[model samples]
Each structure stands twice: as C-alpha cells, then as structure tokens.
Target: MQAAHELSQVQLLSVSIVALGFLYVSWTVTRNLLFSPLRRFPGPKIAALTRWWDIYHTVKCDKFKVIHELHRKHGPVVRVGPNHLSFSSPETFRQVYVKGCATFLKDRDFYANIQPGLGPKYSGLFNYTNHQQSIDERKLLQAKLSPSALRQYELRFLPILDTLVAIMKDKAELDLFAYFKFLMLDAIGDLAFNQSFHQLESGEEHQYVIDFNNAFTLIGLSLKDAYYGLQRVFKYAQTRVDAFLSEEKPKPGTLMEAYLENGKPKPPYTPWYIALSGHGFIVAGSESTSITLTYVVWLLIKHLDIQRRLRLELKNVPPDATGAHLASLPLLDAVIKETLRIYPPAPSAMPRVVPSRGAEMEGINYPPNVRFQLLHRILNFRLR
Candidate 1:
C-alpha cells in the first residue's frame, strides 16, 4: 500500500508539472498576441511572442539586413520584439537622437551584455547606459580630444602615413583593410597612451588586440545564449590587458598619466578602470577609423574621376597641410561625406528606452520601458 501511495504521489507531481508548463505557455501566448501594448504594431507573430526572432538574426550577424527587410515590409516602424520597436524615418530619428527630443535613456538591457564581466563602471562612452555618468567620464578626456588638441595629434599622423606608403610599396598586392587596422592601432596607441602598438612597423598582431577584436565580433553576433561565455572570454582578455598595462610606468602628457594623476583629488581611478578605458579606445577608435578609411579608399579607387579630382585638390595644398587646410577642400570634404553615407562603420540600430513620462514619435505614443531603436543604415541608405 505504501509503494502504491508513493507511485501515486510521483504521478500527481508529473501531472502538476505538465499543467504548469501548459498554463505558462498559454499565458505567454495570450499576453503577447492579445494583451501586449505592441500587439497592434506589424511584425512576425513569433517576434511579438519572444525575443528569439531577434536573437536568431543577431547570431547570424545579419540583424541589420533582417531589420531593414522588416522595415521595408512593415513600413517605418516595426515591432521587432515583445517590447521593442525599430524606426526608419528622419522625423523619428530626430525625435530619438536629437538632443532636445532625446529624453529616452539607452536601453541598459542591450548594453548590459556588451562588455559583460566589467560591470557598469567600466563601460566606456559607446556602451555607457547612464547619461550623466557617460557625460562625466567623457569630460575627463574632452580637452585631450578637442579640436585644438586633435590638430597637434595630426602632426603625428604624417609619419604613420609615410610608413604605410613605404610598407605598401614592398607588396605587389595588399589587403588595405589589414594595413588600415594596423595603422589605426599604432596611431591610437601613440596618441592616447604614448606607446606604439608596433603593428604597422612589425607587421605582427598583438594578442590583446586580437582578443579584443574577437570579443567585439562575439558581441556583434549578439548571441544571448552565449552571453555568459562571451563575458568570461572578454573578462579574461581584459585581465591580461590590465596586467600588461600595470607593468608599464605612466609617462608624462599621456592619457594614462592624466588618468592616474586625476585620481588624487576625487574618485580614484582604479587600475581596472584605466586599463578598460585604454582597451575601449583601442577597440572603438581603431576599428571605426580603420573601417571608415578602408571604405573611403575603396570608394575612391572605384571612382577614378572623383579620385583624380581629390588628388588635384590635395596637390594645391602645402605638403605640410593641416587639418583646417584639409577641411577647407570642398572636393575632399564631399568625397568623405559621400563615403560615410555609403558605408557607415557601424550601420546598426542604436536602441534606447522610452522615458518614464512616455514618448511619442510618428503619431504613435509609447509607454515607458519600451525598447526602440533608430535604424541608422536604413536612414543613410535612403539618402542615396
């Protein structure tokens, strides 16, 4: 009788578990399809039910294409997730990104997975979700990156460009992308940290650079299921980088020196903070600039007539031309503008959270906490 009772208890437990599972599924379906605020927005039904739709395309690293297609199919605004909308219109873009209208905060959930294991404190400018914190952190280096300071840095670029030309002459055919990556890495290393990565000179890659690049690729893939694992790898890479940087003594006038000295008065700059900031600059600065330069070069090569015009314009300037001088060149400026329009380094959606007061765009009012993104690539492509 005791054996029979035990068996009955086990059977009852199984039935209860199955019932709970069924109820959970039913409630989710009901909420997503019939009760959710985003239900009226047009998108694939599966997307409204779960984030799996977005995750799938993200893992494929074709999220931009997928979102672009969705926008084309569903119009300017498409419900991409249960509480997420994507906008592809100039008015909405202005509403979301312009200073006066950009009341919405960055979606922390999206950035949370970006540089995982570093915590919120280490998130640099691009990934920092907290507006005030981002502002404060940016203020620290504002002077160094200002227009006047940048002109001083421009002098350093001449030798690097000369080295790049020298290197290319030796090779019958070259991968401009790789060369650009090397050039930018070395440039940022010297300009930001007063050290040269030597990638351009040595024709060898640094392990830290490689690791950070891998981390970036993983993050770009947006594999939520692999978030923890990706974070682990990123943290390990960061630890190695921090260890490397800690061995070097701070040099005068370098950003690292400023960071170390700045710690004396107020909130101390931890070693991890300094290291992470350096890593952020290396990754963000090098990658975007290299990609942009590569695209600019490619575009120029494809359009010989425009390239010839630009070359003629450059010939008219002095050999030791300054950025201000270059800025004055109309043809050069137009070519750069056209290249950037054609190939933005990061042609992806920048997600933001609706403010607590709620927000309205394109005649649709959205409640707080709804995640929406401006499709930059779509907007740029429309310009063409």
Candidate 2:
C-alpha cells in the first residue's frame, strides 16, 4: 500500500509540472500575440514571442541590418521586439529625440545591459538615463569639445595628420582603416590625457587600445548567458583604467586638467566618474571619428570625380588653413554631408523610453514603458 502511495505522489508531481509549463506557454502566447500593446505593430512573429530573436541578431552583429529589413517590410514603424518599436521616419526621430515628445531620458536598463558589470557608476554622458544628470555631466565637458576649444585642439591634430600622411607615403600597400584608427586614438590620448599612445609612430597597437577593443567585443557578445564573461572582461578594463589614472597627472588645458579644476568638487563627478569620463572620451571619440574618416576616405577613393573636385577645392585654401577656413569650402561640406548620410558611424538605434504620460507619433499614441528606437541606418538609406 505504501509503495502504491509513492507512485501516486510521483504521478501527481509530474502532472503539476506539466500543467505549469502549459500555463506559462499559454500566457506568453496570449500576452505577446494578442494582449500586449505592441501587438498592433507589424513584425516577425518569433520576435514578438521572444527576446532571443533580437539577441540572436545582436550576437551576429547584424541587428541594425535586420531592423532595416523590418522597416522596409513594415513601413515607418515596426515592432522589433515584444515591447520595442523602431521608427524609420525623420519626423518621428525628431519627435522622439529632439522635441522630447517621448521621454528625454535614455533607457538605462538597455545601456546598463550593454556594459553589464559597470553599473550606474560608469554611466557617462552618453549612457546617463537621468535628464538632469546627463545635462550636468555634459556641462562639465562641453567647453572642452566646443568649436573654439576644438580649434585649439586642431593645433595638436595637424602633427598627427602629418605623421599619418608621411606613413601613407612610405607604404605602397597599407590598411588605411587601421591607420586612421591609430591616428584618432593618438589624437584623443594627447588631447584628453596630455599623453599620446604613439600607436602611429610605433606602428603597433597600444596595450590600452587593445584592451578597449577587447572590452567592446566582449560587450557586443553580452547576451543573457554571457553576462558573467562580459563582467570578467569589464573588470580587466576597469583595472587598466585604474592603473592609467594612478600613473597620469592632470595637465593644463587638457580634458583631465579641466575636469580636475572644474568638476572634482562636484557631486556627480566623483573620482570614478572622472575615470569613466576619460575612458568615454578615448573610446567614443576615437572610434566614431575613425569610422567616419574611414568611410569618407573610402567614398572619395571610389568616386574619382568627387575626389578631383575635392582636391581642386582644397588647393584654393591656404597651406596652413584653419578649421574655420575649411568650413567655407562648399564642396568639402557637401562631401562630408553625403558621406555621413551614406555611412553613419552610429547606424544602430538610439533607444528612448516613452514617458508616464505617454507620447504620440504619426497619429498613433503609445503607452508608457514602450521602448522606441529610431532606425538611423534606414533614415540614411532613404536620404541616399
């Protein structure tokens, strides 16, 4: 009789487990397919049901292309995830980001997930979710990046540009992309830290640069299961950053010195904040500028007519021309505009959250907590 009772108990436990699994599936299907607010938006059925669809594309480094295809199929608005909608139109982009129709706040959870182990302490101006906080942080470094300030930094830039030109002339076959990256890295290191990585001069990658590149690769691979691995990579980066900070002293007129003079006594710009900001300056500035310059150079190389016209335009300027002087060149301006339109450095979505009061775009009202992203690459493609 006792043996029979044990068998019955086992059967009951199995039935209960199966029932729970069935209920979960049913709820998920109903919520994602029928009950969720995003159901009305058109997208792939699998994406609506699971975040794994998005994660899969992200790991493949094709998330932007996947989103572009979705927009092409689904019109201006497409539901890329169960709760995430991507907008392709400029008007909607302005509404979401510029006009602040939606929340001005960034989606912290998303940004945090992008760099898993760093947490809020490392949230620099780009990733800061709080509006006031981001504004405050931007104020700290805005002067350093302004037009006049950039002109002063250009004095530092010309030498690096000359070095690059010399290196290119010496080598018949060279990787322009890698050289541009090295040039940008050295420029940022000198301008921000008052120290140059000498990547271009050394003709080899710097340790910090290699670490940052590895950290970024790890960040891209950071999905649900890879969180611990991402954390390990970030910890390595953090150690490098700490060592850099300990060894370097702030120099006059540079970003580090400016921060020390103006931001150290402040509330948000703590020691970690300063370190993170410095890290951001190197990574964001070098990577984006290098990508943009690489694209511009490639486009110029492919179109000989445009290159000839650009050369003629540049020939008219003084040999020691300043940025302000170059700004007057119409053809040069047009080339840059066209290049940026064709190949934006930041082609992926810039995610923003809908406010508690909600927001409307293109006559459709969205509920709060809706993750809205502008498909930047699609917009650029449309422009082309």
Candidate 3:
C-alpha cells in the first residue's frame, strides 16, 4: 500500500508541472497575440509571436527580401519580432537614423554578438555605442586616413595593381570577385602594416583572410569554428606586430607606428591591441572595397557609353595623379556615389532601440523601450 501511494504521488507531481507549463504558454500566447503594445502593427502573426520566425529567415539569408515583401503586402510598419517593427519609409529612416540617432541606442545584442569573446570592454570600435568614445577612437586613426596620407598610400597600390594587370592579361575569362578580393586584401595589408599580404602574387587567399571570414559567423557551429579561426588570425597578427617591434629601426608611416611612442606601446596600444586592429583593417577594407570595385566593373561593362565616357575622362589624367585628382572627375565621382546608393554596405536594417519616454515616426507612436528597426531596402521605399 505504501509503495503504491508513492508511485501515485510521483505521477501526480509530473501532471501538475506539465499543467503549469501549459498554462504559462497559453498566457504568453494570449498576451503576444492580442495584448502586446505593438499588436497594432501589421505582420505575419508568427513573427509577432516568436523570435524563431525571424531567426529562421536570417539563417536562410532572406530576411531582407521577406521584410521587403512584407512592406509590399502590409504597408509601412511590420512587427518583425515580438518587440521589433520594421519601418519601410525613407522618412522614417531619416527621422530615426539621422535626426533621432542620438535618441536611439545600438542594440548591443545584435552589434556586439559578433565579437570574439565575452567582455564589458570593446576591442572593436565598430560596436561602440557611446558617441564620445566613438569620436575619440576616430581621432586615433584620423591622421593616417587623411587625403595627403591617402595619396601616399595610392603610390603603394601601383605595384599591386600592376601585378593584377599582368595576371589578367593571360586569362581569357577571370573571376573578378576572387581577383578583386586578393587585390584589395594586398592593398589594405600594404596600407596597414607596410607589408602586402602577397595575396596578389600568390593568387590565393592568405590564412588570415580565411580565418577572419570564419570568425565573424553569427551562428553556433560557426561560433565553435570561430574560436579556432580567430586564434589563427590573432597568431598571424601577433607575428606581424612582433616583427615590427623587433626591428632595430622602427618603420615610420606604418599604421602600427601611430600606437608606439619611443618604440614602446601607448595605453590600449599593447601588442594584443595592435594585432587585433591589424586584422581589423583587413576585415573592414578588403571585402567592401572588392565588392564596390566589382560592382563598378560590372556596371561599366553593362553600359558601354558610360564606360567609354569614363575611359575618355581617365585618359586625360596626368602622370603621377593622386587619389584627390581622381575624385575631381565628375562622372567617375557620380558613378561611385550611384553605386553606393544602389547596393550599400549594410543593405538592410541595422537594429536600434527607441529611447525611454518613447518615439514617433510615420505618424505612429512607438511605445518606449521597443526596438525601432528599419527595413534593409530603402531604395524601393524612398519617399518621392
């Protein structure tokens, strides 16, 4: 009798726990579906109910396209998450990102998620949310990136560009993507460390380049892989820093030089920091520059008249022309701008949180503490 009573008690306890779980889920579903503050916005119900819907699309790499279509079907505002809404108007973008930029904060979960390790301290400036900190960090890099400095850097690129030309002459058809990537990586490696990655000469990606791509993955199997990848990148960067430090004569005009005072590192310019930033240049510059150049090449090829006109303008360039001189050309400048206007670096929504006391856009009152998100496709949503 005692044994039977104990068994009955165990079954009853399990039933109680399950019943409680089902009740909580029911309440959550009710609140999310009908009682949430953002319930007024139109979107697929599944999106407003759970973050999994958004995650699924993100993993599939079509969240932007899906959100664009959502706008087409549902009009301006879309409840993309239980707490997030995607705005499709350029007016909304300007109001939030331009005019109200200060009012909103970078969503740390999204921006900082890509960083290598756990920390309250930020190793990368790209994820910095504090405005003054951002400005101060830019000051460190400002001098090296100025126009005159850039002109000097342009001279360094000549040999690399020549090598690319030599390689292209032999091939009937070439992969511009791979070639441009190699060229840009070498160029940036030159600019950053006063050493080209020699990717253009080798005609293959360096180990550092491969590791960086692997490290920045936002998902799990990728995250586990990221550790090994980042370790290799840091090792590569440390090797360069070690070489620079070991030099009897410290090389002037190198990016690493700015961080050193009397051959010793400045605060936050420790060996580790320098190495991290050394790779960061490759991260920021190589991929985007290649993408932009590839787009420029494809578009110019597609439009022969524009290509001829651009070629005619280029032919007039004087020998030893600087980057500033190239910018002086009207059509080339316009082409660069128009290309960015079409395929921007961040093609879609960069999530930002609306400030306390709430915010308003497109005549809708967004309750405070919710994320004020924008759709990635602004060209189609541009306000006429």
Computed on alpha carbons, the lDDT of every model, listed in order, comes to 0.75, 0.76, 0.80
Q: Please list all clashing residue pairs in model 1, or write none if there are none.
A: none
**By TM-score, who's the top model here?**
3
Ranking by TM-score: 3, 2, 1
Q: How does model 2 score by TM-score?
A: 0.87
> Which model, 1 or 3, shows the larger TM-score?
3
| CA deviation > 4 Å runs, candidate 1 | 1-11, 100-102, 118-121, 216-253, 257-268
lDDT by residue for model 3 (67-122), tens: 87887888878899988988877788888888876778877777776455445533
Candidate 3 backbone clash number: 1
Q: What digit string (tens of lDDT, one per residue) describes model 2 on residues 15-68?
A: 999999999999998999999988998999998998889889987889988888
RMSD of each predicted structure? 3.8, 3.5, 2.8
Give the C-alpha miss distance for residue 65 in model 1, angstroms.
2.1
Find the candidate with the highest lDDT and give its number: 3
In candidate 1, residue 354 scores what lDDT? 87
For residues 171-214, could you state the per-residue lDDT of candidate 1 as single tens digits? Answer: 89988999899999888876655677789888887655665555
